[model samples]
Target: MTELRIILFLIGVAVLGAIYYFGTRKKVDIEDELDFSEGEEDIVSVRPNDLPRKKSGLTVDEAHQAHEAENVQTQKDKIVTLFLHARDGQQFDWHLIQSAAEQVGLEFGQDNLYYRFKGFGNNKELIFMVANMLKPGIFQPDMRTTGLVLIMTLPGIMPALDMWDTMFPVGERIAEILGGKLTDENHHIFSRQRIASMREEMREFDHKHSIQ
Candidate 1:
């Protein structure tokens, strides 16, 4: 009887030990799996939507105005543009256009367009640029265009007002020579009022830059 009791006790202890071992091993394995899952999450890439965005406290119009002001500050000069167009139902003759440009002291050079320079040779300063109103913006022999575009940068080799003064007459001369009409950028007639307004703007620009 004693022997049987001892055997029973030993069997109970063995069963309890087995249960404890398996339970502890299972718990360790579950913890290791959880740690591995966390490590994978750390290496995963974050989605763009999850990233933070900056909140600018400016309204759309205010932001646009600020951007324009910044551009004006950083840009070397302000651009003034004018157009020369043929009469309705008419196109400019390529040969006449070339002659008119040359007559106005414009040289056909860079970008296959014409340029007016302030001085001679390498010391020359570009006053303004001219381009064909058509696509590719180049003057080619035997090619007709409805118009030409003149672009001048203000506060260039001279004061803004002075540059405008120089460029306007050149446009007028080209118009006269080509039988074309001088127009504003909007293709409206270059009226006296518009000229006055543009001169005033140039004056303001010159004053702002402290240029004589």
Candidate 2:
């Protein structure tokens, strides 16, 4: 009877060990599966960059090139400038020119009923200005020893073609008032034919860029 009781106790011990081992293993397997599932979820969220490139319409390199091209074109467009020269290699009289410019600004402002013209920069040596009637910063005035060069530009975009009507006329008027000469970038005398050609070129640009 004693031998039989010892055998029963040994059997119970072996049964409990087997149960503990299997339960622990099952728990470990469940925890591992949960971790794997969470890892897959994380991968899905973070792999958006790996999505089909065609679905985004352009690859990263192509997008970057397009942006660069746009910048180049804007620079080119801004370079289409108009100029006015003071007579006989002289610099403009600041007070007289400023008064004439202000008058022109006021007249244009009244006609537009919305846009104003204001000078830019704090340099007492120069009279830099912009079309307040249109968008701010669309025009910039460069005062050199020879004359003032007006570049049609904004911070990052091209100047509007419609602004040419106002800009060129205002420039011519100011030059006339100041006894200055209206000249091209090369200091060539401005003539009817030259202005007509400029207008045609601007129209072409406006058409191409769908500006008007």
Candidate 3:
């Protein structure tokens, strides 16, 4: 009985030692495989002249301007827009648009197609955008317009939300000055009822996703 006990104890020790050895070996193998997989990527070779080059040698301001140009459409998508429409049979005057924008502290950006404005409010500098409201199906270099639209937007790097108080008054003021009527996305005349509804929507959206 004593001899049998000794033999069983030795067999148990051997089994445990085998398990530990194989476990450690497998762990080392896995780590090595991971390290190999994560090694630096191989560089593809090209002729010296054929190597990819920047489209242009841009200065700092030029580079920043290029970046902004690329993000124009992206920024446009994230905005709250309000339109000011000219009376029937009247198109917005480009010169008037420029003058009104300047009076309201907006600068002439890019082509006369759009105007840019910024102000410090609510602990941040808010960006305001103004652009032409062209007639439907029109895409020309200098297309005639119904009036202009004000877009409360942020840069591509910033978040988008409804900024009612900040934008509504400005739109109203501009419309008043330009002799145009305020309208919504569907051409509904902007009324107090519409403003209240928009306020509620903005409040609900803010609740779900904080603008900051």
Candidate 4:
């Protein structure tokens, strides 16, 4: 009887050991599966080449060429200017200038300067602008200036020649009224030769624009 009981106890111990080993292996397999699932999720969430980047436009050389072309066009469109200066050791009186500008059909408007317009009312187009030679170039009450600048942009609302025709007479009249002398842009005496040259230039400008 004693031998049989000992054999039965040994059998029970072997069965318990098998159950424990299988349960531990199954738990390790489940944990390994969970770890593998988490790794798969991380890989799926990662995206290659997802960062934003600047879109390519012009190349460096092309951009520089474009800038140079714009500058050239701006130079071509630059204003053509003439100056009117008071006689030596003299300055122009503000009241006289106002009256002279008005007589020449210049109206005080934008930039506190004077402008000569082409038409009447809303249809009016700017022919030229006149400003004080002083810094900031605004005409104010009781202002006295040594000179003035008359300016017009090329290819204006009117043909360049016609614009010059209107502008020159207006400058002449204003100078005559104010006892001033009309000069070139550099404030040098405006010679008859220079006047003829300017007229030719204006004609050339008008012709070029007409073809365009």
Candidate 5:
């Protein structure tokens, strides 16, 4: 009888151990299934470089051309960058900085905004120099502006700021200065009319792409 009892106790432990092992495996299987399902649904977000920098739907050779296209005027010879947010935009906030620069009469050359940087931040900023040598606290509208409109679909995914994280905090600080709270929930952050127009423009752009 003692021998039988000991055998039964050992069997019970073996059964319990098997059950625990199966339970742990079942939990792991459920987690694997969840991860697979989530992975199928979520599309990976891409960086600018990761995406093919297409022959931009639009391009401008000079800041003056970009400025005139946007209907903004600038007298000061400062480069106006749209940061990483601008896709088709040539010039934005050109007049804002130009106006401020005019106040100080701190004249620079138009050639400055033309050169491409070989060993600087990733966007290889052209418009950034204006914000670099800033006389801070002068243009106190809470941010930098050039009177030029920034044309981009995703404003939040600004990459120009990330590129210049090493040298100084100019791009990020300037972006923060430019952005502000939207008064109306329906109102767009970038531009009121242009934002509304972009939906139609996107459809046309898509249609044109499909035809090709």
Candidate 6:
């Protein structure tokens, strides 16, 4: 019985040793296989041109301008169509539009302004009156009414302005016929700072128009 017990103990020890050796060797073999599959010689070759580098001196403004200008142009293309017509059959004035355009610079009409005139209090019919005269079919801002309309649509485009604050700039529209007084009640969405900045911009805009 003692001899049998010794033989059984020896057999148990040999089995545990075999299990430990095989377990360690199996782990090593798995690691080797992974390394071999991912060998340096098998790595993909990337040319210097294929490696993308961060472009230097790229501004957010430039990127945005590029992205927006990727397709059609003109402010009319950017948003829902709104036509500008002079009341009483007076011709829409080009000088006025040019002056307003000058305020915002050469890029003014490039998909930034989109005007929908609901009119101030007591004047809900204004939009219908203007629309009735619109020539059917889509058109970019006409030579006549471009500048005056640009001013109203220019102020609310900063990235900081929340979508709700994107109301039209009712003040400083710079047209003798219109823009004298719109009630400020509905326009309170703008910060005082924004209004002040817009006014200053219009002043500069007017100055540019005078020179031309």
Best by lDDT: 1
Ranked by lDDT, the better of candidates 2 and 6 is 2
Q: Which 10 consecutive positions of candidate 2 have the poorest summed lDDT?
A: 35-44
Local distance difference test scores for all models: 0.61, 0.41, 0.47, 0.60, 0.27, 0.28
Worst 10 residues of 5 by lDDT: 148-157
Report the error of model 5 at residue 7, Å. 84
Query: Which residue pairs clash in candidate 1?
Result: none
lDDT of 2 by residue, 39-62 (tens): 112211112222122212454565
Instruction: Per model, state how many residue pairs clash.
Output: 0, 3, 0, 0, 9, 1
Candidate 1 lDDT tens digits, 1-212: 32222222222222222222222323233322211111112212222122111112334464455446435544544657777878776888889998998788899874466878788975666677776654445578898877777876555678888889988999999999988899876667878899999899998998988943
- Residues 52-149 of candidate 4: C-alpha lDDT, one tens digit per residue: 11111334564455445545656455356777878877889889999998898899874476878778986766667776654335578898877777
Q: Native-vs-model 6 lDDT? A: 0.28
Q: In candidate 5, residue 118 scores what lDDT?
A: 24
Off by over 4 Å in 4: 1-72
Superior candidate under lDDT, 2 versus 5: 2
On TM-score, the candidate that comes out on top is: 4
Error (Å) of candidate 2 at residue 196 is 0.6
TM-score of candidate 1 against the unseen true structure: 0.63
TM-score of each model, in listed order = 0.63, 0.45, 0.51, 0.64, 0.18, 0.23
Query: Model 6 — TM-score against the truth?
Result: 0.23
Q: What is the lDDT of residue 95 in candidate 3?
A: 66
TM-score preference between candidates 2 and 3, better one: 3
Candidate 2: lDDT over CA atoms? 0.41
TM-score of candidate 5 to 2 decimals: 0.18
lDDT digits (tens) for residues 86-179 of candidate 5: 2232223545444434443233333221122224534332222222211110123334322211111111122322222311233233344443
TM-score for model 2? 0.45
lDDT of 3: 0.47
Candidate number that wins on lDDT, 4 or 5: 4
Candidates, ranked, lDDT:
1, 4, 3, 2, 6, 5
